[model samples]
Target: MVTRIAKCTCGQLQITVEGEPLGVGVCHCFACQSRTGSVFAALAAFGPGYRVTGRATDYVRTGDQGAKFRFRFCPVCGTNLFHTEEGEDNRSVGVAVGAFADPDFPPPRDSVYDCRRHRWVQLPEGITVYDKDPE
Candidate 1:
């Protein structure tokens, strides 16, 4: 019954998520870092229980698994809001955790691509981490 609201920087996009997120995690993959323009990317998984309103543009990429990753961002402000993998249906989206603008929303419970993580950046202790993606 937890509902969270996320928005694009310029307010052109808004995503409202109902219920708890399936999971929260951090990614250190090169692609994530580049796409987010940060050392790492934090994501919250919402399973088909969210609604998105407003206009956003999309960019697509091929994942290592050959899955299509479609990124949605606000065209007006160029803020990357959320993304979905191919065949996921409307049932799921991996949202940029920061978009909520809530400092206490939640911390990542998993860390992926640790090998690619920047040396100076330390992850929270005692969660879960994978040298690469989880097996």
Candidate 2:
């Protein structure tokens, strides 16, 4: 099993997860863009086999489809390190792929909300593209 460490810019918050992510994807929703200050947000999802360290601040928001998410960020640096879907029984978590700062980190396998994706932005080949979040 491979272990990965993702941390905030200020190093105040971190998460350690064992093994590869269940899925890696990118989101182009306006909310994601706003949260990341980028055209899109890339994240890796992990199961319960993970541990979190340090302190973080939470900002809860509802998605377009009405699913609520609790985004966690470093209090010192305000780095949006991770987020979790609310009302779900599973303890799955989505960690910002950029937080790892690993140049070789895996590319996103899925792309959501392509309608909102920037016109100049092009995804890699062989990726699953969705006009919107799949139901």
Candidate 3:
């Protein structure tokens, strides 16, 4: 199994993910835009049990679909880290690519929320595009 390890700016926090990501994408929804403070939010989805170290601050918000999403960030530098479904039973986690210490991370496999994407943002060709999360 391939695993990637990431360390936060303070060096006190560590995140480790086993195996390649299940999926990678960017979200252009208003909520994602606001949370990321950018036109879109990029994420790498991983299976359950990925390990995260150090203390993280969490913020929970309800999506337009009424599903609750929880975001976890480094408390010190306020760097967005990962997001997860609200309930403890949920098994997937989405890690922010920007938080990776490696400079050679792969690009996203898809882009989502095109309906809310800015007119100036141009996505690469052939990648999957979705008005919202893929059905």
Candidate 4:
């Protein structure tokens, strides 16, 4: 298992990953774009049990599915760091790509919520794009 580390822009926060990410993707839902203050959000999904260090402020809100979504950010620098589903036994964590110390991180393997995707954005072909969560 290769270990990866990321530090927040302010240099006070650090995130470490024990192995390769479980998945990578971009989200285009209106709520996501609005929360991220961008056209879309890039994320690297990981399995449960990874550890994060340093203090982060959490913002919890109901998602499109009515499930609680929690976002963690640096209170001082306002750097968005992590996102997780708020419930017991939810086995996923999303690391914000921008928070990575490496600038050459690869692009996501998918783009989700394409139905709400901005008209000017063109996603890669043949990726697992979804209009919503596959259920």
Model 3 spans with C-alpha error above 4 angstroms = 88-90
lDDT of 1 by residue, 14-126 (tens): 99988888899999999999999999999999888678999989999987667798899999999999998878756589999999999988889999999999999988878
**TM-scores, in order shown?**
0.95, 0.97, 0.89, 0.88
lDDT of 4 by residue, 50-104 (tens): 7788888899988777788888888878778888888748568889887775676
Cα lDDT computed for each candidate against the true fold: 0.90, 0.94, 0.84, 0.81
Candidate number with the higher lDDT (3 or 4): 3
Model number with the top TM-score: 2
Q: Point out the higher-scoring one by TM-score: 1 or 3.
A: 1
Q: Candidate 1: list runs displaced more than 4 Å.
A: none
- Among these predicted structures, which one has the highest lDDT? 2
